[model samples]
Target: MLPKGFFHRRVVLTAGLVLGLTGSAFGAAAGNTATNKAPSSTSPVGSTNVTVADPTVPRPPGTPCTVQLFSGVAFNDFNPRPYAYAPPAGCGTRWSKVVLEADFSVTAGRQFDRTATLWLGGVNLYFGTTEEPSSTVAPSWHVERDLTDYSALLRQAGNGQALIGNVVNSTYTGVIYGSARLLFYPASILAPAAHAPDAVVPLGSDPVGNTVSLATPSSQLSKSLSLPTNVERAYLDVFVQSQNADEFWYTCVPDQYAAEVQECGGGNFREAEISIDGQPAGVAPVYPWIYSGGIDPYLWRPTTGVQTLNFMPYRVDLTPFAGVLSNGAAHQVAVNVAGANNYFSATASLLLYLDPHAKTVTGQIERNTLVGQPPTPTIGDTLTTDSSGNITGAITTQLSRHFIIAGYANTSHGRVDSTVDQTVGFGDIQTFTINATTYRQVTDQQTSSDGVSQSTVGGFVTGKYSEHMRYPLHLDVNQVTAADGSFTLATVAHQGDEKNLAHQLFGITLYSAKLSNTVDSDDTLAFDASGNLTSHSNQQSTQTFAFNDSLGGCYRTDVGSFSGAVSSYATGTGCPGQQNRLFWFTHPDGSPENGNAVLGW
Candidate 1:
């Protein structure tokens, strides 16, 4: 299951993927952070920044359907047990946006350290502390993960099967509980021109499974899939995870781009670089996964965890490359682990949206043309460390660099052009400890800017975009445990007033008018050695825009406000809505898990 939106990543290359990219990687990048910064020479800024839509596309009508396409099964063992989901009743082909959702919960007092996963077709949806989220103590918990990108597999065409399993925990007191489903939002809500891939081709291995660890260098894997004919749009959807690789990437790479106050050493900030037949395609950022930390809760999880649970995958809109790849030939699509480490692991798929009328599609790879890339990043000198290998030191990345990638897809539909600019102008400094109870202080000031432009056969059927984010991040996470086994996971994450302003020019109206949303969240989660919990959190987000319902859009200039105050360790329903959704974003930029998407990658 692959995902996509216009302005193409919102500009992401995240934990190692490209932009919820306008969302985190540089998978997706961090979008909500820099909401108010000035646009760059390559960035799209302001309301007057009109978006042109395809004239021939149908005007959306009626309320979209939110269907439950699948119901997942539960698992408690790592025996590769399987779960299943069937689409909502009345499901049909008219669907446009589809998202996979999973709800999994585990109570405290369990000694489990394994991941829970659901696999459909080639797409994988992970639960628990798997993939990358640290599997530490928390309350009996339930979480909903989004998998809209893989809507292709949630089809009524057949019954979908998902495999569920977790690494065994000897203390085993709590059962691993969960289910999976898909939420479908009809195409009628979007312009008839809304795009959905006609074919989703799995390009790599792991249909069975593969481990991304030291056994595999850089966690690199490659495969080639045949392309469909008349392809007008395409996307490279990727999933990857690594345990114990978090600190290496987060602290080592410094910033995906060179920083100002400090400079990064070590070539660790390597992204998931892809190539088509040896030609460079795109880059996916390597995330400093929460699972990459030490022996904790997530050790048993898959890829640390999936994005819906804060873990994520990288996606590259192959649409720009659509023109050059529509030959319906067997093409070479490869994922590169340029990070030079075996901790990063990955699996990839290429999704294509067809244009039946398109007689041909072709394009070229031009790296550093629009969105420049950072040079090889280096890690700073290792600092003094404790007996447990917890290094107590500071990092100063002294390089300021920029990465640009630009190209166009030529097809019967005209040119699908794109230019992305990801700049790392400041320093990304971090201090961390890898003991049982971890600690980190990160002060990062950087910018990730992105834009995409397109036109159809008539040229009037056009698309334009601009999104520039200057996110300056300052956060600290201290998950400390006392000798008595009492522990607290305190996190204070702050995003300066910044805006990732993105406008998709489609026809005369603008939809999803999310703009300049300032963000800041603080929380302190505490638990007994047995994992009972009380969490106190305060979060604020303001998404301001001027469009409204009358415009047949949802981006009315407004704000979303929410807060929480809790100090007691309550179970089940006691904590209400105390969970911190720190990575939430809006508009062109989709969150790591869900959003309104115009282009389905």
Candidate 2:
């Protein structure tokens, strides 16, 4: 979400490897040097802690391209939201990286043929001993023959090179692909090879389909490939199996390049379900909690005094504190509480390590029903992850800002139409910077006896302003209203020089729409006692809400004015009171509106 100007590609590396190559004419005639040397049986290549390529075939920087990563909640606000690492626009979002040992057994049937090939700037390296004075000369780099000892290699010849350096200059730049890979430390803790479950391959043949099982073992090939590494970042192109997507699982490494990995603080929680008239009308994830026997994905804690909340179907206070193991790996200990059959508490610990050689995060979680009760603890699963970089690939923590507007119905509606979804998000902690852009692409879909229907829309209008801008969009459908949609975008313009302010223009209501052409131009401002911008609007039923306390811990005021009409009619005309108009307000934590004040016509 960085401003377009913030994103520029310059020559990342000019002195290191580039100068090493241009220094002498020796590389010019070294075109026929070996890429790597073969290892002896006593020194097996796969047997050493230090892995290196044979001198004849240098290492290949597998993929030569730059990717902008982002994580945290994109749309679905299921607690910590889902984490995603998207590449820049237009580029294919699905990127893949595979590291497998190149034993003859696995590569026998593979299409590519070569024991050792160096990939640099999108080009492959083919090395052979031939005394020819050619410009395609390989560098004399040493690679591990078997981990214990290093083997020497010479330059090689290659003409088809892909530009990998700086995209802006049209000049391939950055650290040499071979050097980066050769320097990367070993994989964090050596994890056992993982396996996927068997499944029948699916077929779309007109008549019938068959299932086939695919096998992929967790293996790292003894080769190094570099992409962009100057930024403190680590990312993995994970291929999630269909079945595995049911929950959050990790398959990547930690970033040795990260500057630091620390535990930020947390907060309190408040939950409520909307009640039109004291009856359970509807519910969302607002202050929601889940009490599955250690199966629920609650907010995680890895630091002390640092707080987080559990808002799903169960509510729990989270405290975070740093542990003694604060090396590249940091740990957080937490306690979960409630008070009897429903009351439970426990202390849990989690690791936040970033060293490439120490990749996975391992910790434990424990809980009990009593104050003095011994804790029943379970091991928190390990995650191989990368610390966020300067530009920050994505906010690994909660970063979406949302509210809950919900109501109970005679029949539960699946998430389809302008239906109110309980949304949860974070505000401006160093976590929610310009790098955090909220893209709301909503798809309301349904299938029933009447028929099947689907409608889709996106709030691209939200991305058209400054970094501090906040936009809110809503969609709702029930018995009274056929469907409805609204968009609210807001940004602050600081007082500046008159000339710039005049030229720039201030307080402009770009667009607003309702049922027809009526211009709902009435403006409204909502504020807490301090008059902070809780919510404001030039009415199209637009609104912005602020919790008295941030992190949605306290909802004390309506920060913005809202003006909208609800068309839903009561299920029956037998109501004793005024026309049954249902109004719902949602919180970022998924709580819905319960109070109702009649508005006279």
Best candidate per lDDT, number? Answer: 1
Compose the digit string of candidate 2's lDDT tens values, residues 132-189: 1112221122222110011001011112211111111222211122221222112112
Among these predictions, the greatest TM-score belongs to: 1
Alpha carbon lDDT at 206, candidate 2: 13
TM-score of each: 0.61, 0.14
Across 1-601, the per-residue lDDT of candidate 1 in tens digits comes to: 0111101110111211110100021111100111211222322212211111100011124454554434444455656544345565565654645544454444434332333445555455542242222124322223333344455555534433444344335534445555555556555423232244566666546553333332233344566666665776666766655433333344444343223212233433445667776665665544433331221221111111112233345556555566567666777887765544435445666766667776666766554442344335544634465665555666655444455555566766566665544443334666644444444445453434343333333445454444343434555655666777666655554433233333454553233333332233444544555544433344322223222122233322222333321111111121125221111122222233111123222
